[model samples]
Target: MGGLRNLSGLDASQLVIDGDLKISGNNNLESIADLNGVVITGTCMIANNPLCVGCTCGSIGLAAFTTSTTTTSTTSTTTVTTTTSTSTTSTTTRNPAYEGDVLCQSSAQLADAAALLEDRLRINGMVAFSNYDSFTCDVDATTLASMTAISHVEALEIRGSTALETLAGLEALAAVEFDVAIRGNAALSNLSGLDTLSSIGLDLTIRGNALLTSLSGLSSLTHVGGQLAIQSNPVLETLDFMTSLGSVDFLLISNNPLLTEVDALASLTSVNTLYVFGNDELANVNALRNVTIVGDCFISGLKDCVSPDACSCSDL
Candidate 1:
């Protein structure tokens, strides 16, 4: 069964094919309904079949095919009361929607999930990729580009992507209504892909990115409706790129080992709660001269300072 082009007339529901089963490049094939109870030995290569959805290979047993039988019953009364029942015992069955989290490990699976998200957003105005209310991506840069079509995600997280050097191709995403987190991405060095994002309705967190050197990509971000925290980035040396940000409900800058200057936040004037701690090289809070309406302020661990007055502050 190698190069036949079409299988429209083949109607075998239960089949046993020995050796490797290779079905590829079937352009006209849409459904594999006839191969429902089929069994194949060795490997299964089912690719380049564009129209296939929810295709599964039956389980392998001993050295032959094992098929399960299902039964159905229907009863009707004189008043037209009908009852139907179905019972089956199968080795492999398709899971229903209420099973659990939908795992999307491969790019193809992610594409399918993205399409479903797009559909849900069109009908419902918002979508959470899972029960957790966030769309999580652990894919490479190429696969991440494929996600640019998604625009209505409530929350987003990009982590564990080794090949992501820049956040490019996500130009369509302009808002995150909840939270946005970029963490634990070793090769991610820039946030240029998020230049279009101007606001975050909740916390904005950037942490645990080992190779990130700067926050220049976030230059367009003007407002953070909730807390703004930048912590644990090893080589992020400055916050000069976040100059446009003017206000936040809370602010924190901690544990960024090489961050020495923060004049980028010169425009920021108001914060309800503020904390600046554990930044080894942050000599003073001079960059916060414009901050006049702080509800609460906590400052510690500035290497070049001895007291609150020594931190170029007349009051705390």
Candidate 2:
């Protein structure tokens, strides 16, 4: 349309401005606010004062908006989930809900969502933070610190954040039922600071931590209301803290070589399937000998199942 400014101040619903609004002749056309949703065409090069909401300028070169309601939370803890080594296809899985009171979104289109978060999260509907779970960003542990501007979210899936190296800003999340998946972040080192994350009453996944040497810091991760699967963490040598666990159904930990001595596993008598595979260093399958193996006992890599007085792996 020739006149892009025709819809200005128009209460017309679903008004869409296709092209960039420019004052061709007026040199004194001070910056203006749309006071309504406006879509821009092509790249827009406007000063901070000229930008408007819903301004879909091409590629967003340099634009800033300041509203008193723009909530900014500072980073308090600097923790990161471990990395993964193998190629695995992601499956569709729904986990528990909010670990705290508010859920923050990094890409707030409405611009003032934080102000309504407390209100929308009244009964059940979660305030969509960042609208992120639907897409993936190439962020790693080292860069997670820069996402401090990201607001609170009840549940988050940065699993596809290839460049994500840190799990910092998440300590502020106080929700009870949360599902966190940071699977594919290759450079993440340790889950040390995630000690605060134990408060998560539901499922938690720190899987794919290929270089993770130990799980000592996660000793606090004992009481999960649901399943806990930490598969393919090959370097996780010790599981010292898991003895405190009261219940678990599918406790899958495969391909972890250094993780020997699961005697501490007695705590999880409630688990139905205890998959311990590809663990070469595991010599004693006896720690699990006493427990009633209701399901398959995948202690295959062991040199041999301990001989119980001559039965040679008796079927008890």
Candidate 3:
């Protein structure tokens, strides 16, 4: 027992107990066969082992000697040590997912999703860096705040965001480009104060917001470089603000089931492609005299025009 500490025959991976062992060392193992943290493969055969005398069949083959582990005294008190260095100097911190970043995806990962350009994006540049140049936020019906606190986005596409309740704060956008597609927000009801937008460089698509009843928000977009489609917003009884739009190359307003009058569309002068169909209550095509677009004008429900306009749909 005296020369056993200096024997240097201990294996860290596998320990074999051949003798009837008595554990004594507080931090060392006099006999590791008595420990519980270690695993025993063969029939521990507690019935045959010497330590388990009165234990029942429940503790039949195994035993726990967690209390008996004691430390052994060595000639030198240098304990075991790990070799790997514990340095954390070069590790980098990562950014968490949040609002106001270009290209946000739910399941399908996006490409070129550059991290927040600068942390303090609101104060640095005139152009909204929190701006979305080319991206789609096809969120689930549960993520309704898809329109919250949207301070600066260059181009935003909202598709299949079904639980969107309101189109609020979009009136505050001063300069948004590319496309602002609010499609499939089925629960959207109101677009109250969106007349402040003065300049747009691309298309503006507002489709399938079922409960929207007014065209009051889009009264200020004076320049659109591409198409403008507002379709399937049912119960929208009036297009009273279409006269304020400055220019549109292609204008489409279709599938509104209950639209009655489009008095404001008579003032549109810059449209190059005009289409109004699927609206059951519409009974006049006289207001389409000013359109100069290049596509089919499917004015299928049009009637009762005192002066038939120069459109190729009816005037041809």
Candidate 4:
């Protein structure tokens, strides 16, 4: 059998492969720029090709290859190319379930990130802010506009944005297919930008945002497919923002020194597991008056919180 030196047959705009692609040890190959439109329904593997350069293998969108993959080049200096041109890219082919996580370290890379997010209707992996933790520049309207334009994402995490005062840029964000965790932003004051977010397909955790005093922006959220947690904000006064929320498997609210009430979560009716602790000002759980079922309950550390009759269920 002649080793494949040219992939002329696979160089079509609508190429489709029903099974895995395992191409390796080719000494004559040069570039995979021609296999741009190829779609493999299974896994892909390309390794030990001495002359092969660039991220042609990864240029094929990970969504096309639905299974695990690996790519090893001869020079050992791996670079990723994108289907659509973008300054930021990630090398993927390891796990089938995820295409790759995109990291945007600066505002200059926001365009690349927007391009990546705009490549498809949904992203199978993560889009993160790497340099936000210590960013000195403002997370401007243009940056937030790009981030908010993304309607479907697997996971969205923002950490340590010291100067961010609000989620004003993320106003258009409506859905997170998986988790949304916001932590360590010292200047963030409210959930004002996520005003349109109505659903989270998985967990939602808000922690360590020191200046955050309200959840007023999450007023539209009505469903959570997994857990809901709010913790460690010293001045947060209410859970009134999530008034529309009704379903969650687990609930956790803890460590807020000024949070005196949870009356905002009055709409929640189901929780399989719940833990409420560490808020010194919280006096009662009158908000859980509609909660009729709980599998396990852990409530302690709130000096004035009296056990309400609504949580008097058989399981806990």
Highest TM-score against the true fold, candidate: 4
In candidate 1, which residue pairs clash? 167-193
User: Which pairs clash in the backbone of model 3?
Assistant: 25-70, 25-71, 26-70, 26-71, 27-70, 27-71, 28-71, 132-154, 272-293, 273-293
1-316: candidate 3 lDDT, tens digit per residue: 3222221344523553432223222222123322332222222221222232342212222232111222233343336853443311111111111233344554343222322322211211222111122534444323322233233456656555545455453545555656667666666665544556666577888887777777667777677778888788878877776666656877787888877777776666666777777877766655566656565556666444344443236662
Q: Find the 10 residues in a row with the least total lDDT in model 4.
A: 86-95
1-316 in candidate 4: lDDT tens per residue? 1365667666546776766665666777666666765655445666556566653446555543333344333332336742432221223342232256766777677677655544243456776765444553334345555554455667887766666677775766788888888787778888888898899988998998889999879999988888888999988988877889888888888999888888888898888888888888877777886775557887776654344423323223
Among all windows of 10 consecutive residues in model 1, the one with the lowest summed lDDT is 91-100
lDDT winner: 4
| TM-score on alpha carbons, each prediction | 0.59, 0.48, 0.52, 0.62
lDDT of 2 at 13: 38
Model 3: how far residue 121 lies from native, Å:
7.0
lDDT of every predicted structure (CA atoms):
0.63, 0.44, 0.50, 0.68
What would the TM-score be for candidate 2 when compared with the true structure? 0.48
In model 2, the runs with Cα more than 4 Å from the true position are 1-136, 140-154, 160-166, 173-178, 199-203, 263-266, 285-297, 303-316
lDDT pick, better of 2 and 3: 3
List model 2 lDDT by residue over 112-166, tens digit each.
3333322121212333232245643344333344323333344545454444344
**Which residue ranges in model 4 land beyond 4 Å of their true spot?**
1-100, 105-111, 114-121, 131-141, 306-316
Candidate 1 vs 2: which has more lDDT: 1
